[model samples]
Every structure is written in structure tokens, then in C-alpha cells.
Target: MGLDRAASIADLRLKAKRRIPRFAFDLVDGGAEAEVNLRRNEEAFEEVLLTPRYMVDVSRIDTGTEVFGESFAAPFGMAPIGMLNAFWPDADLTLARLCKRQNVPYVASSAASTTLEALAEAADGNGWFQLYVSSDDTVTEGLIARAEAAGYEVMMVTADVPAAGKRDRDIRNQLSVPFRFTPEVVLQCALNPRWALTSLKHGTPNVANYADLLQSATSYADVQKTLITPSFDWESLRRLRDRWKGKLLVKGILHPQDALRCAEMGCDGVVVSNHGGRQVAFGPPTIEALPAIAEALGGRIPILLDSGVRRGADFVRAKARGADFVLAGRALAYGVGAGGRAGAERAMEILLLELQRALGQLGVPRFADVTRSALSDMPASQD
Candidate 1:
């Protein structure tokens, strides 16, 4: 009943689905194409089998990890999600505060409903801004300057999403950027009065990250056109790195060559993500790609991972395979959507506790010690 007692992200996910409108819920829950990738993401996590060892001093374990020169309380952090206000009034602020209290890094989306300065201040020094390259270079420059001035510790440039994915749920539910609910959607909103009243009291959500570059689009159609650009290139990444003083991370990298390219380009890190199965219809899950990418760029740059990370063991799998750090997007969405800051906090607590237990069982004292050699894939055996 209480927030701290929450056991799983699924608990929060159900709550979020109930509180948020159908369209809003679908945006966070649904993925591109036939949703095969989405299902595979979660299934991939379940596929990893851990061999635990006993008779070891497993009384204590440490999950703390340092990335981009800053120590984090855990090996994982929250990945940035767009249109956060759709879930709660000020979802960005909620996540920022929670990240501070939890001491895990919070990456703010470029399409979030809160301003860069506001989130940076709210998150204190734990904020990391996720940048979506704009079509205009001048706009991009200003955004870089804003994040630098806001005291963000890291600047993560999202290199995926050259164009918006064709999410069938969004189309069916009529959910877009500003979220103009159709009559059916309006009825769904009315059914969830708590969400409707709170949303009304706070005023409509604005695209805060692009507040200066463009006016906030009030409809789904308007927002889609403004949110993505197909022309985001290597030059854009170089320009962003040049302007931002903090650690620069490139998100949405899946290719091993691309991971090496980021290292060669002087990027600080690369998040091997398939946009949590939201963008591409098919690809190797982040876990499958972790080892190769990490092996290629292990000493060069921090290899961060996201996608299908539902529980603590998933983190172990990623770390053992090659990831320096892990991140979760939908799980936090489930948390915040389920019960605001308390729910989000519960999600982190659940992860940390589970991770601690997992570390002890695996005969590792430190989370980072669960390295590549600690794991061996199931081999073909005599039947």
C-alpha cells in the first residue's frame, strides 16, 4: 500500500496505465511496427541465466559505479523519456529530485516539459541532458549553451531517430506531442478524472527543451514534424561535443563500428540502445550487442546499455557482457506513471536491492566485478 513497500515495476506500470489517458499510456508502452521488438526486449532479459556460487563471504556488496568522472550510487541510471508531463504534471522535476535523492544520474530529454535550467537546478549536479539534434545549427548551439550553463554533468546526444517511428498505438489512440485526445480518448480521460483534473490545473504541457527554438505544438501532428530530423550527422555530433564542456555521451548506438567511431571521435560514452525497441522494428537486443561493442571500445569509452532491462539480473547480464553502466527508460516510466516521485523512488529501491542480492549470489562483492569472463554462454552439449 505504501510507496516503499512496492515490490515491482509492474505494480507501478498498472497504476500508470490506470491514471494516465489511453493515448498517453500507449506512447510509453507501445513500440514501432508490430510490437515484436518490444516483446523481444523484455523476453531477452528473461533469457539470461545466472549461475550462483555459495560458501563465499557474501555478507556485503557494493553497486556503486563512476561514469564520466562522477561517482554514482549504482551502476545504472534513468534514461531520458520524452513527453514526460503527459504522465505527471512535472515529470522531469520529479525524476530530477528522485535522481538526486537516490544519487543516480538522471538524463533529461530534449523534448521534456521542463526547462534545462529548471531541471539542472532541481537535480542539483546529477542532471544529464539528452539532446535531439535540431534541423538548425543555430538552435542546436543555443541548446548546448543552455545545458552547459545549467550545470549538467553530461550531455547525451541521441543519434537514433532520424525520423519518428510509426507507432501504431499512437495512431490508433490519437496521441501526439501536445496530445489532442479524440472524443474516444476524451472519454478515456474523463474516466480517469484524477489525471484530467491534475492536468487541467497545471495547464497544458509545453515542449520545454525547445521552448526558444520553436513554439510548443498543441497537437500530435504538429509535434511529430518538429521533434525529429533526418539530417543529424557526424558533423552535428562533433559540433555538439565542441560546444558542451561536460562529458559528451552518444546514445542509440548498436553497431560495433559505430561504438569504435564514437571513441575515435572523442565522445565520452555510448549507450547501446535500440530506443528500447521504440524506433527500429528489428535489431539485436542491447544485451546481444553489449559484448562486441564493449570489447571494441572497452578502454576507449564508457559503454552504457538500455533495452529490455526489467530487473536486477538484467543489469548483471549487461555488466558481465561488457557494459560499464546500465539505464532503464520504461521501468521509470512505469514507476512515475504509477505513483509519481514515490513510485519512481520505489523503482530505484527495488533495482538496488535486487542488484545487491544478485551480486551476493553470483560470488561477486562489487557489481563491476561481474565481468565478461565471469559469464559463459550455454554451449552445445551431448544429449
Candidate 2:
């Protein structure tokens, strides 16, 4: 399908599914275990209904907002996604460039196929780095120093993956970084010649940030043992805060107490996410968890929400429900997967247009005007 015809994020996702191999597609699209929370995240947003005021002047709608001492053109930004090369060659750089051009935040993941410095340069040093803390102090410290040196202003420590979730789709597909090519996988790639040839020309995707460390490792399991921090805790956050001088935010927080603790510990912000339902199968939808966290913090710090944010109306719902910003992961990834840099641009274009239209329909002049009063009561069954 043409980019112009792909009118929504859902359309981009369908295009992505047809463009890439099943294993690669599943990596971006699937959630953990039974994906109960995955479905619920999107469903819960429908519970929030906007009450529009008629005959209001919305002729000058402004989508601009500021976060982390930087002004963004919109309240929505790209959430970090790992191994985007599985979607397209240099997908991380493509997204960074897109965000830079759009003047939106782009959080680069530690597990990305491109280096942090490369992504930072692509984003004109405006990108944020999302670190997956390691149990090893030296490794963690090295990453922080690298991010600082690369001119990343904000550091987001992911706190939810105490252990890896059981993602059944990846298990069934036997997905790995280097891709263990079984006959089934090979045939799937063969069917998608464009993706296979592009990947062949660009080279296979690897965890670029951990390239040096993985050099001595023999298998993906060994690489995982050296990278992920199964014991990350509040103490770890404290130590990281002391070492990293830039803005620090915590991702993967769903509970109000955890959000409050991050603020009390001097975190600049908290992203109310469940890792897009990739880390926890039964966790509450981010929308359901957002209000309590917002109330607990009382706007002490910016609270961003991720997971299942598809439409512009969903963005308005999140803001009305107390999210300072919203992050889109699968939507952007799907765009890149479907049509490279152009596809990614199309995704952002669609979102920007949708946000503008949503605001106009709601008779809100700016995103900051969105409040709890805008939302109608949830249905009794939904409540």
C-alpha cells in the first residue's frame, strides 16, 4: 500500500506485517505470555470520553510542550524500542532523524542496533538515552559515561525488567539477535525478498551498544546474562543519580508509590509504562495506572504514558487522565517497518494531523487545557 493510503497507525502496522518476515514482525507486535494487559491497554483508553465545548474559539491550537528543559513541538514522542533493525536497516538512525526534523523526543534504547553516539548525532544531540541497568557496576557506569559524552541530556533507567518476561511468540519463532535460521525462518525471509535483500546488504542486526562486551560472549544467553540487571533496585537508582549529572527519569513504573519514590529521589520524570505489555502480562493498563500515580505525585514531575497509544484521541485521553506526555512505540516501528524513513515520517504526520483534529473537535486551544473534567464517567461495567 502507498504511504498516502496508509491513513492510520493500524494501516501502517498491517503494511509492516506484509513487508517483513513473521519473526521480525512478531518482535515488534507481540506482547508477553497471553497478552492480557496488551489488549487491555488499548481497551482502557476507550473508557475515557472527551466532553467537547461547542462554540469555542479553537482557531489557534497549539501542540507545543516542554519537558526535560526542552521544548517539544507536540506532547507525543517516540518511546524507545530495541533492535529496530529487525524492522528496517538503520531504523534507529531513521527514527532519530525523524524526531529531530519533527522536533519531538526520541528515546534511544540500549538494546538498539545503532550506537548511542550515532543516534545522538542523528538527533542533533537532542535524543534521550534509555539505559537497561546492568548488575555489573563497571558496565553500568561505562554506559552512563558514554551517554553523557554523546551529549544525551536525559537518562531513562528502565526499572521493570527484574527478570525477562515469557514472550511466547518469540519462543515459538525461536527469535534471537543473530537469528538462528531454521528452515521455517529461512522460507519466511525468502518470501519477503525486499526485506531479506535490504538486510543482506546492510548486514545482520546486533546489539550495537553492547558490541564490545558481546564480542567475548558465545551465545545470546551469555549476552543477556552480561547485559540485563535482574537485581536493579532503589539503591541502584540512588547510585546512578549520584553518578549521572543529567536529567534522570524512570520507565516501567505503574504503581503510585513507585512514582512517588522516583520523585522523592529527585527523578526529573516518570514514564507510566508496563513496557508496552512486553514485560508483564497481567499488570494494569497504563491508562488505569496513570491517574493514581498522577495524584500521588501531584505534578511534582512530568508523568509520561506509553503502551497501546494508537490514535490522536488516545493522546487527548491520556492528557485528560493526567499524563503530561504520551509515547508511541509500535506505531512508529510499524511505520519504519512498512516504508523505511518515509514510512516513519508518514506515521508522525498522521499523529500530528490527528492531534490537531482531536483538539479542534474538543474545542481545546492547547494540549495544556486538557483536564480531568474533559473526561466523561466510565461505564459501570468498565469501572
Candidate 3:
């Protein structure tokens, strides 16, 4: 379907799958292991039924909200996506500009194909940085310092990926670095001329932020080994917290104890994510994991939800289930994959439109007003 006909994030996904090569699409679409948690992420959200409070003056609806002294046009924002240009040439800068225009937070991934500095400038003051926490302390420190120099206010450290999740699709596709041109991949590219031609014009995306270190690496495997921080622990977190000197957040938090400890230790917030079901196959869906984490924090920290949030109602469900705010990576990636900038714009339009309708339908004035009281099928916890 054309962008004009694409009405939902799912439609965007379908268009993307048809537009890009299998290996390329699967890189964004596939999750870890059997992808059980991926399916669970959306299914769990679907099971949450929001009940309307009816008879209230629902003539007006405003979805605008704020986080960390920043006002967003909507309650949600874009999460970091690594190698974003692989989906569409210049997608990283495109999305950063999109976030600026949309008045939402734009997080630049450490592994992004575009430099953090460029993304920061494109995203303007709404830019945030997400760290993968390299095995080398010097590299980590340099990245931290560069982000600060670029004027990033918020820095998020990923906690779930001590080692990379074994994504099965990458294995089957022989998805390797330096753009492996298997006959099948070549054929897929041939079929999708728009993606192929654009990719040719832009060149293959790489780990732009880590160019210095990556240039010295022999293979992608070596690159992965050098980057993965298996030794990162609470001590490492404390050290990072001491060094960043910005609004710090820990992403990939599921356990309540971990969330509470992060709050106590002075983290500005925590992104309650399963890495969009990409990191852990066995972890609980983020929606189901939210309440206990919320109760654990007890309003001590901001809880941002990520994973399988496609529709606008999904945003409301996440907030009602206890997320202070929500973020989506694949949803936006699907947009770029479908058609570049216009596709990404459509994704945001679909989400914002759906979000406003959801709030109005639920009779909630704003995102913060959506409490667990909106929940129906899953009864309130009788604490």
C-alpha cells in the first residue's frame, strides 16, 4: 500500500517488509531466540482493556506532556535505533529532524550509523544519548564526554545486553558486516529497486560513533567482542553515573528491586524495556513488568515503557498499566523502511492521531490522568 493508504503501524510494517530485502528487514523486525517475548509484548498489551469513565466533558483532548523539564507535543517519543540508515539512507538524520519537528525526545544510539554530534544537532535540544557500554573503559569515557560536549541532557545506559542476544534470523540470512552479498540477498535487492538504488547512493551504514575503534577491528565478531560489556555491574553503573554528569537513566530494567535500587542510587529515570523483545527471550513483556516496578519505585523515578507498542491505544494502555511515558523503535523504523522521511512522518501521524482518539475515548484529559482505573480485564492488584 502507498503511504497515503497506510493508516497504522502494522500497515507500515507490511510496506517495509515488501520494500526492503529480507536480511535488512529482519535486522529491525527480528527479536532474540525464538521471539516468544516479541509476540508476548504485543499480546500482553492487547489484553489490557481500557474502560471509559463516560459522561465527562470530553469535548477537548490534549496529549502534550513533559519529562525531565522538556515539553513534548505528545506523551511518547522515539527510542534509539542502531544502524538506522541501513533501513533507509540517511534515516538517522531524517528521524532526528522528524523528532525535532514533532517536538519529541530523540535518542541517539551509540552504535548508530550517524555520528552522535550530527544527530544531536538535528534533534536540537530534544536529543538524548543511549550507551551500549563498551568493554573498554576509555572508549566508554570518550563516548560519554563527546555526548556531553554535544549538549545531550539525558544519557541512558543499557543494562540487559551483557552479551548480544542470539537473533535466529540473522543466522539464517548470513547477515554479516561489510554488507555480505549472498545470491539471495542480491536477488532480494534486485526486487526492491527503490531500496537498492537509495542504498547505493548513500553507501552501507556502519558503526559511525565507534569508527576509530571499529577501523582497527579485523572482523565484525571482533568488533562485537570489543564492544560487549559482560563485566558491567553495579560498580560499573555507579562509576558511569559519577562520570556522565547529566540526567542519567538505566534502560532494560524489568525487576522491581533493580528499578528501586536505580532510584535510590540517584538515576534520573529508568526505561522499563526488554529491548523491544530483542535482548531476552524469557523476560516478561514490558507491560506486565511495569506495575511491580512502579510500586517498587513508589513514584521515586520515571518509568518509560518500550517494546511492541504499535497503536495509539497501546500508549494509553502502557500509561494506565504504570508507564510514565512510552517509546517505540521498530514502529518508527517500520516507517522509514516503508518509505524514508514520508513513511516516518506517517508513523508519527498515525500514533499521534490514535493517541488523541484513545484519550478522548477513555474520557481522560491527559496522559497522566490515565490510571490503572482504566484497566478492566486485568483487575487491580488488591494490595
Candidate 4:
């Protein structure tokens, strides 16, 4: 089906599944262990009820929002996704350009398949960099310097992944960086000719940010070792906060205390996320976790929600529950995976339309007005 015919992100997801190899599809689609947290992320959003006020002037609903002192065309932006090109050829650059054209933020991942400089160029002023905080201090400091030189106004330091989640699908697929091209993988690629041909042309996606580090690094294991600082702690966060001159946000916050600590330690914002349910299988969904953090922070700083935001109403649900802004990785992932830029733009267009319609239904004029007050039931704070 064409981009216009794709009604929902689910449609695009199915389209992507059909077009890409199963192994590649599962790499993005699957989550850790039994993926209970993943399922809960979406299901929690379902349980959130909204109270709509009628007889109000809802004619002009403004989805435009200001976040971290920057104006955006919408209330949400594209979340960072690593190895995006592995799922769709050149998807990293595609989504970056998509955000640029759409006037939304694109958080460039430290692990993104394309170079940060290239994505920064594509995103222009709309780019924010998400850091993984490598074990090497120089590498970590160098990345921050690069982002600053590249004109990224914000750097989001990820806090959730101390160790990589063991995704069962990847294990089953025997997935390796630069792709091992085992018999099964080769056959799977052969079955999905479009993906196979496109991937062959794109070359195997690698850790582009670690080009110099990986020059001597022998294997994918060696490459993986160069990523993510496992000993990262509150001291590490404090030190990081001290160094970055621009706005800084701590991602992967679930508990209110952790959220409060970030705020106390001077983080510009906190992204209430479960790492898209990829970090832990039993963690609370981001939606379920937002109210407490909101109550704790009491709007001291901006709050951004990441993970499981598939539709425009989901963005509304997040806003009503308590997110100042929100971000989603898989919408653009599904978009690019389905049909590159057209598919991504279609997905974004669908969300923008959905958000406008949802605001109209809620009798709210602007996304900024969407708060816990919009919740049908003013329930007690959630832990």
C-alpha cells in the first residue's frame, strides 16, 4: 500500500514487516525477555481516561508547543533510535531530514548508524543529541564536544541502560553487528529481496560514532565493548552535568526519587522512560510512571515521555497524564522501514492530525494546556 493508504502506525509496522527481513524486523519489534514491559507500555495508555469539556471554543486547536525554550510545530518529536539504518537503509538520515522539514526535534542517538555530524547537518537546528556515555572518558567528552561544535543545543544523557538487554529475537537470529550473514540470515535476506538489495547498497550499518575507536577494534563484540559506561552512577551524572554547557536531560527515569535527584542535581529535564521497554521486562510503563514524577517535580522542570507513543491520542494521553512533551522512536522507524521518507512523513502527518483531533475533543485550545486536570478521574499519585 502507498503512504496515503497507511492509516495508522500499525499499518506501517505491518508494511515494514512484510518488506524487511524477519530478523531485521524482530530486532526493532521485539523487546527484552517476554516483553511484558513493552506490552504494558501500550496497555497502560489504554487505561488512561480523558475528560472532555464541551461548549468551549475548540475551533482553533494549537498543537504547537515550546520545549526547553525552543518552539516546535507539534507537542512531540522523534525519539532517538540506534542502528536505524540496520532496519531501513539510510533511515537515520531519512528521519533526521524528516524532522527538519516538519519542524520537530530529532534526538540523535550516540549509537545511530549514521554519523552524528551528518544527522546534525540534516536536522540543522532541530537536532538534540542523546548520549550513551562510553567507558572511555575522552570518547564521552569528545562526543559532547562534537555535539556542541555541531550546534546541538541539548544533550540527553541516557540513564537506563547499565547493561544491554538480552533480546530473545536477536539471540535467536544470532544477530551481529556488520551482520555475520549466516546461512539463515542469507536466506532471510534472499526472501526479502528489497531489504537485501537495499542493505547491500547501504553496506552493513556500524557504530559510526566510534570510527576511530573501532579502527583497532577487531569484532562486533569489541565494538559493543566500546559503548555504554556500566559503572555509571550518581557521581557520574553529577560530573556529566558539570561538563555539558548546553541544556541536559536525564533519560530512563522511572522512580520519583530518581527524578527528584536529577532535578536537585540540576538536570534541565527528565525523560520518564523505560527505554521503550528494552531495558527491563518488569519495569512500569512510562505512562504509569509519569503521574508520580509529575507530582514530585510539581512542574519544577520540563518532563518528556518516551516509548509506546504510537498515535496522536497517545501523545494526548501522555500530556493529560503529565508529560510536558513526548517522543517516539518506532513511528519514524516504522515509517522509514516501510518506505523511507514518504512513510516517515506519513506517520508524522498522521500523529499531527490525531493530536489536533484529540485536543478538539478535550475542549483544549493548546497542547500546553493538557495537564492532569484533563484526566477524567483525579486519581492519587502512582509509584
Please provide, for model 3 over 239-356, each residue's C-alpha lDDT reduced to its tens digit, 9 standing for 90 to 100: 8888878899999999999999898789999999999888879989999999899998888878999999999999899888788888988998899888899999999999989898
**Which lDDT values do the candidates have, in the order given?**
0.81, 0.88, 0.88, 0.88
Q: Could you tell me how far off, in angstroms, the CA of residue 241 lies in candidate 1 after the best superposition?
A: 2.8
User: lDDT of candidate 2 vs native?
Assistant: 0.88
- The global Cα lDDT (0 to 1) of model 3 is 0.88
Lowest-lDDT window of 10 residues in candidate 2? 374-383
All candidates: CA RMSD (Å): 2.8, 2.5, 1.7, 2.3
lDDT head-to-head 1 vs 4, winner: 4
lDDT of 4 by residue, 65-134 (tens): 9999999999888898888888999998988898989899999999888889999999988999999988
| Per-candidate clash tally | 1, 0, 0, 0
Model 1 vs. true fold: TM: 0.93
Model 1, residue 357: what's the lDDT? 88
Displacement of residue 232 (Cα, Å) in model 3 is 0.5
Ranking by TM-score: 3, 2, 4, 1
Itemize residue pairs with steric clashes in candidate 3: none
Question: What lDDT does candidate 4 reach at residue 66?
Answer: 97
lDDT of 1 by residue, 208-266 (tens): 87765456556655565566668888887776677777788899998999989888888
